[model samples]
Target: MTSGIPDSIMALVVKQDGYNPNPEGGIHFETMEPYLEFKEIAVPDLAAGQVLVGMAMAPINPSDLHFLKGEYGQPRRAGKPAGFEGVGTVIAAGEDPYAQSLIGTRVSFAATPDGTGTWATHAVAEAMLCIPQPDSVGDHDAAGFIVNPLTAAAMFEEAKAAGSPGIVLTAGASQVSKFIVALARDSGLDSICIVRRDVHNQVLTDLGATVILNQTEDDFAAELTSTMKERKPRFFIDAVADATSTQVFNAMGKDSTWMIYGSLSPETPPLPNTGELIFRNKVIKGFWLSPWLSGAALDEKLAVFAEVQARFSDGRWSTEVGATVKLDSAVETLVEALADPRGKVFIQP
Candidate 1:
């Protein structure tokens, strides 16, 4: 280890061969015990463009769960720490000037594409991926800096660029959906939010959801069809890629587009509405945050980081903390807490 940095760091890591996938296909208490193991490992050395971050906190996103199952886009590296993003102070830097400049500065960073992750006392990241955090943005919000916020901003931009009169969003109670709903409200674009629980989702109206509908309602299909016809929405941004998503896409008029970003449901949806594709100009596509960020211009990324900080600092966005798991107990406690995931989950390293 260099200078004062410790020779060893405590991390919650996965054992490659020992990783147990829940038969049900998601994280579950019964089958998740071996998914993570708490260990004391040697500190990783920095590469030329990397910096060592002493992690303060990291959020548990759906991507992390998918990662545990080897279902996410990136392959999970066993024996390494397991977190995608976090807020921390850069304690050490590599030979590069940009990395050196970040030393001792507190920032929010995304784990490198193939690096040991942030669920540890110290983590390594490329300097270019780190965003210096403003004092006004608290630790909780900073922990969730990139994934949800950036995706929300990018998807909202997609909706606007599509020239859609309104957009349909599934999983209305989620943080990303709330941010998009608020953005649409400010931009004067109509938004329809769909959720399972009527009582809990009705409050979405406060976040700028022009219409909040319960998918389980008896007359949901008729009501959605009527509203879609009236609104003439041409874009459906979906997280749940199930039969319901297909139903929502079918509700829209001709020339509509369905953009799927996540698959919260285990079932795969089929392209049953081929007539719309053949006759009309309706299309189906996807949106992934990784490529979008990598493909964005430097100025655009910087502007997004600045705007995200401003929004989180000014109360326009709040990443609510539901549970903060200790590094040692994460192997077991995390699965139970995520059963409901009442608010955002965090790991304080």
Candidate 2:
């Protein structure tokens, strides 16, 4: 047994055996929590170069929903705990010197690539991937620090590096998009925020968005094309890949790149437009955090993480937490608690 650690860890695990995500294959949020079983299991043992995180909080993100539906990049085990990222203190560490150094530190962690989930009392993560949490950031902010904020930073940097005049964002109401909107404004670049509803307009506008377009409005197409002409936003940070993304991509002038980071929609983007590919020089690509972080330098990752912490620390950027669902009742209460998408639902012990 390890010091300051218990043998059994209680977690909300998914039973993936019989649940079908339906014939259409989109994640049904309501059915997801019912498939989860909250129970006790032995704490995962750490190997060399790993640390044991006594987790504090984790969020239920769109990615987590996709994973529960067995549609995420990683494979899911039948009884495996369900979560991706969380903040916790290192209660135990394996023999590696770097790992041992993290023994008493609080850190934010993503689940290991080997499919170890983070929704647990304790998680075994590689010491290298456990980012030290700054004292300025609280557990609520830190639990979600990695996923949305880091993606916002990386993708925004990509647009900046390309010298984009403005960035176009689909699903602008999302946490990542909100961060990007504030970033573009602070950088003195235009942020064209696209949303399905006009109700999200004020929140995004308050974040300094250059343009807000409601895809449901009748004038959306004209606004998109006109904005494309004026702002010349060639870089698209897309989260929802559907007909709307197609329309936005079509409106661009030339050398436009559609960077899809999430799949909130089930419809595949009808692509391979011979003209766009052969003539206009448009391209489409995917952004998965694991591969991106894995390929980045240690220094770059640390710099981005630190910068994100500073943003959350200040009032400039923040993720709203509507409620904190206790671990014991997470399975029963998570879905209802998360019904309002405006604020995030956090799970904790």
Top-lDDT structure, candidate number: 2
Best by TM-score: 1
Candidate 2 deviant stretches above 4 angstroms: 17-26
Residues 1-349, model 1: lDDT tens digits: 2354767889988666433354334333465566778899898777888888889999998878777777777766788888889999988888899989888889898887645788899888888888998789999999999999999999988899989988899987888888888889888999898898875465577777888878999999998999998899898889888889889887889989899888788777778488888888899999999998899998888887888888898998888678888887888788777765578889987
lDDT of 1 at 191: 88
Off by over 4 Å in 1: 17-29
The CA root-mean-square deviation of candidate 2, after full C-alpha superposition on the true structure, stands at 2.3
- Score every model by TM-score: 0.94, 0.93
Cα misplacement distance, residue 231 of candidate 1 (Å): 1.2
Model 1 worst lDDT run, 10 consecutive residues: 18-27
Evaluated against the true structure, the overall lDDT of model 2 is 0.84
